[model samples]
Target: MAWVQFGHAKCGSREPTSNARACRLEPRKSMSLDRFGHSTPTCEAWTMLQSMRRHSQSFLIYVLFGMLIVVFVFMFGLPSTDSCDPQTQIIVAEAGNFEINDSDVKSGTMRTFGDTLRGGDKEFKAAQRQVLYNMVTTLLVAEKAEDAGFRVSDDELRQYIVDWEKGNPDQLRYISGGKFDKERYKNFLDYYGLPTERYEAYKRRELLARNYLTMLETSLVVSQVEVRDLFEKRMNRTDLEFIKLEPMHVEHLFEAPTAAEVNAFLAEHMDEVKAAFTANKSEYSTPAKVHLKEIIVQKNDKMLRQIGTETDKAKAPDTRFKILKKAVIDNSMAFDEAAEKYNEALVYRANGGDRGTEELENLSKQHRDALGDKKVGEIVAFETDLTYNVVRIEEKLDATETPLDKVQSDIASTLIKAERADKKMDEVANSIFERVKNGEEFAAALEAVLYAETPAEVPPVDAVDPTVVPDDANPADEPKKAEEEAPQRVKVDVAETGPFSLRGASYGSWSRLPMIGDAPELARAALTLTEASPLAPKVYTVEGSRVIAKLKKADTGTDEQFAGQKERLIQTIRQQKSAALLGDWRSVITLSHPEPSLQSYGPWVQALFDQAQESGQFKVNQAFLTPSGSEVAANE
Candidate 1:
């Protein structure tokens, strides 16, 4: 490459025959050839450069055209508003075709999340989050289950509902507690502010989700060992002493008073009757919490008579009634003011016609009947003894507590019962103690024993009591001949019974036991048996029953025997392990997920667990989870 000199400055040197202006640039071109392998622009390269320029121009034009279309769409065609703007939409969430409106979100109601959780605390947001999570999770899980072909069948659902109804006998209380019989269900939904269908849908989802989870868990086969182990751990595990008060006979107090005897007594107690009248005058008085305004007649004597007549009738008023009514129809003034204007001779009218605190007892039952129909500011007309009585109730107290005077009879009855109980208990205690001293068992001495005898006929093999601990032979269980088998109950006619203990119960069907309520003493005696000194019979008194318990036997087996039963023992051990796992797992699952819908438990199962949580039957166990996830139980 050659350099050109221009005004003492070094420039590319021009070629010998080349133009000087072009030569300055021509040397730069030669430098390009050093970088590549070409010196000057070629014919083929020029054509390619022109084609590249054309392609670039085409791409640019396409991009600009697309931008123009987008701009146009955004400026004129697109819906221009925020999605969450309250003014733009009536609702936010939708369940199927149903819109969740602002009205659905409790505003000023007492049941609002604000009222239930926060009150006025900043922790309200956290509380809201918890509620939202639970609600959403419930909805999502149910939805997923439905998608997976899990559904409640009509027959199964109907049976489930029947069982539910059978279970909750007191469910009618939720149905307006005996107000309107026909509208009970409707009223209940209204009280909760829920549409009936919506509530049903919610329940369906919740139940289906629960059923799905239950199906999953139960399909998990807990072995026989597990079942037996759980049974052992649970059975006879709870140690509790139940103290029960005996039911006293109250019929003894009332020896059936004759009608003639009562009449003669009433005659003799005429002064007492007068005293009773004086004592309960307040009870007789109808004291209603009535916001009262009295309206008296302000018409001619003839008109008053006509108004009085119309008030007594059940039918519509006549021309004379209309004339009298129009005379008192003061539309502009308040009812109270109208009452004052109309009332002239009435008792309340003299005092601004405001019956401040009218005793309901003072009014006749019929007049009082119409009082309920009258609102806080409306005139109700009804016939009284003297004249037409039009009254407005400012307020009403439906029914107050019974006065002390009114309940005197009840008090007298209760006192009589107490006195009878005192007298009877002394007689009962003496009778019981004397019988024991006379060498008779306490249970045998009691006239009415709750513990009944087994039928003479042999009962079913499974009908034997599971809780009854069997008696052991003092000499030891001998290996008797194959023909000589043991009898169910031991006959100890002459020989005193051996040491008593709850060694173990025979596998018997539990439905055949005598009605023995709260056998605490028997349980105590059974629990405290020993071999050294055989305990004597202890008459343990418990609720609704007495027990005569004597120790039969108490002994531990040898290791040789344990070795012989080792295989059975290991099976037992395995079962115990399985049971333990089931118990722990059930406890965990039940605590986390409980059936809140089932409020009450059956009698047999009641002893197994605490009652439904929210009812305050069982204390909250922070350490334990109840069957219903509604509460954390505090079990000691």
Candidate 2:
């Protein structure tokens, strides 16, 4: 990789720049891969590369390279907040003789997501595991396809390209007047970054996988019995009237512990309380250092150079810093809330950026500047070329510890209150199911359990909105258990999942039952319900919430309808079975090569990667590898 200055040497035969004879070469720059990352490139470099490419005139090579760049940018985006490499090396995972690289997992993930790893690192981590599982499975199955004598020839690849060109009528301009123009074809291919020979090889592998799957699947004859069962299940859609409850939603129903109860809890559990305080003694200790919280903003050129330059408020760069400034500086939101809302790095975002306490000697220059002349409760919005920290000086603690005796009463009350809230969540949910199961109406059961207390008999309606399901029901989780504060007017809801097949795809997965979330118990019970036995047998717990569902209605479509849709149903079932068959192969692959397990970058590499940052070598573009990126976690 030589960067040579192309000009005529001591030979005085330079007619013009382009026509110059070969001359003494000069190194334009020394060897460095740094420019490839965040470093800016000179326009001269582009001019030189163009000149070099043209003199050789590798139209096909240039076109393919151009397309690859476009596809890469389209799928993963560039320089996103979470962008960092995964552990140890470029080749991240292995299976038998085959290995899955960072590039392979990344390209495969592009099938289901496009620049979708924006929520934060945890979401990216989960997606990474799932897609890695998908890829490993695909690779092993593809290998099996090859072993089963499945092969895609060069002629086949060429034919695929030609057919694609013919099929895309909008690209007809490349074949004007019924005659293909070679240069025009090149231009057209350039837009798509047309598949090169290497990419063609990848396609060939996938083609083999597809063919092998087809061959195996074609023999899957859906018997009459299976067809009838599938048809019956699909034709009969059941509706469920369900009551949703969460500990977070209804924990308010339980009042604080009585003085007598608090004293009794202390008498019985003083040792436990002492142990809890010892474990979380930081809550009572003050070190001779500064306590800080930061809303971390990634460094970018716009933020570095032109952030405050905008005079009009609307014209500001809408980076994390902009959001943080508005929330913490102007609008007076808590630093943690701002971090949770806007910080790109989950390590800092998780605990709201609290760096519990930092000794002055170990503080970075940036931190020192933010803290200079600032006392406790002060803040400084600060930045460097690499980061912009919305630093809040939470405290400047002296070396001191609050004795356990100082907070013994408060701890005892909290422990009892939390215990009661946990018990009450189940009690309230079971109460609803018990009464409703015993001939009580649904609305009456909810109102009596949630609002006003009465006899065990169910009472009246106290539904929230009743228009749409609560936002929490969108398969998102509730707050963790027992982190209760003041009483909240339980935001409970009563809704009905109209009618759906027990096994039908609702919102893309059967696990995600409509308006009830991934509660398999409620879904299974709903499927079993009929007019005679409408209520689910038990309260189901999901993400700190409980639910009890009743059957609303069931629709059994006519056999004539099944007759009309028989062929389509068979095809869908065949496809599903084929997918499951591939899944079986994946399970086998996973068992064979369990290192870099789907859940993580495996223990062997994790030990090497546990370093705060693998910023040393093999920097994975976090956009590509996603998951852990660099683990320079704030650990607040």
Candidate 3:
């Protein structure tokens, strides 16, 4: 959604062009580029570049840059102003015998960003780069297709253009009863300032590329065995959930340690408590942090619309920012109250915009500068490239160490709970196991043992009506009271690990139940379990932690499901093959461009474009590319 599409035209309709490509950065992925060099950089311009020495980085700057000047500016600075721009019609690259030019790339970028051009320079550069690459890749791959004896008939080319026009939605105006008007087509190209010959050549190149790509996709046949494997992986996996038995889970069953017992334990185990404190001493030590609340002012269309419709003031960022500053900072409103009243984004409005305590260094430079000299309860305003932050300093916390005396009880309590859990886990497990054997529901049994709610084996006879004394014998023999004992409950937590297959999981993927730790024993039990007897045959001790597992949901592959999957798997495999092929193709084309994320395994193609740049086979000027100008050294 961030990148705009030009391959598809939607008049008033939502349909895309048959060949619409959403720009992206990847090998085998598409992009536009300048065709070749028409003019060299001027001597003075060359002199300036030599002085700067700081060349541009890679096209990966798409990720580096932002709505602000972007990482592009950070890494390379602006491209020699406009002085470094190549002459018009300069050729940028060559694919087979075909030449790519500056105009093609410029036109591509224009079509991509269109009239409004919202994303500024970052999007424009990324789109331009992608379009050029796309053009080269299309031609190179199309040439290969032609060599493979793939011929484009005139009829096929015409049909491709017809499909392209249809994507425009108002295509009916150019076609009468499905017949395209040649004159109308000419007029259409003229409206876009494209010559008939150049435009047709572009369309024909695109048509050849598509046909070749489709062929490659069709050629990679998926085996039935692979399909079945995927089907089992997806459909036969078990949805298993389990809980690790911990002292806290059955805390209710443990009677609170008495003061005397606690005292005795303290005398014997004060060392353990001290050990825990030492182990987690850093947590007891406070770091330098600041507690603050903030109100965010994000620049958006609504704020502009609020200024006025179709007015000059509405288009200006400063005017909208002024209004936002007034609402968020210039007001007499309390910070907390203002957050609820004016923070337009839903995520920002919650908790009255409380950022809580954060390290002061983590604040942006602007906020840090504003808060540097400010004291508690002071407000400061700062702006990021994207949004304005109105902040209230609540407290500046200094790094402080907590005394051991302050946390002794907490340490003791934790150690005592650990002891209690160890004491109760076996008891809880054995009792629950017995109940399950006796046909009591496992869940109910677990719940009863956890919460100390196990029902009495036999209901106590109703106490003889307290007021209604028995008529038999002496009144001295009052009715004996009947009492029922309450069963001990061990509260526990149950966690579910959605679904996973045994083989796939055994191979180190999803091989363990959620919250139960990663144990092969648990994974096997989950897959083999049935709804009738969902519990594992025995309690499992995974590492030091004990757990009981149950199958939450079992999805055994049915013939009908397998039948549906086969067709889908075929389509999936074809897409995979196509992606791989395209990836390999791009890999070869840009092989010389140093990248960290490139394929070194599988098939390797000769780095055609990179080799060409080295061999003087094609022309490229990096200054115009802005970010890839490290290659500008070659021109010098």
lDDT of 3 by residue, 1-636 (tens): 112222222111233444222111111211111111122222233433433343336445433333233433454344322222323244455564555555666765565446755676655655666656556655666666778888766556556666544232224535656766666765655455543334455656666666776676678877887677656756786776565776556655555556676677778888997899999999799777898888665566564223222124524455544554576567666766777765544564667778888987787777787788788988777777766667888899887999888887777777786777677777887777677667776678777776563223323335344566566745344433222232334446666777666655533455655556778877666656898988877777776567766777887889998997788877865665655544444332222222212333112122443554456554444345544433432331
lDDT (Cα atoms) of all candidates against the true structure? 0.39, 0.56, 0.57
Clash count, candidate 1: 31
Q: Between the candidate structures 1 and 3, which one is better when assessed by lDDT?
A: 3
Please provide, for model 2 over 445-469, each residue's C-alpha lDDT reduced to its tens digit, 9 standing for 90 to 100.
8887777652121212332234545
Off by over 4 Å in 2: 1-210, 217-239, 242-371, 374-412, 418-435, 442-517, 556-636
**Candidate with better TM-score, 1 vs 3:** 3
Reference-based lDDT, residue 87, model 1: 38
**Which digits, one per residue and each the tens of the lDDT, describe model 1 over residues 20-122?**
3211211112111111222333222333333344455577866765575466455434211221122322231222122222222222122233345544323
The lDDT of model 2 is 0.56
* TM-score result, candidate 1: 0.24
The reply for model 1, stretches above 4 Å from the true place, is 1-134, 137-211, 214-636
* Higher-TM-score candidate of 2 and 3: 3
Please identify model 3 stretches exceeding 4 Å from their true place: 1-88, 115-127, 164-188, 237-372, 375-395, 398-555, 580-631
**Cα deviation in Å at residue 534, candidate 1?**
31
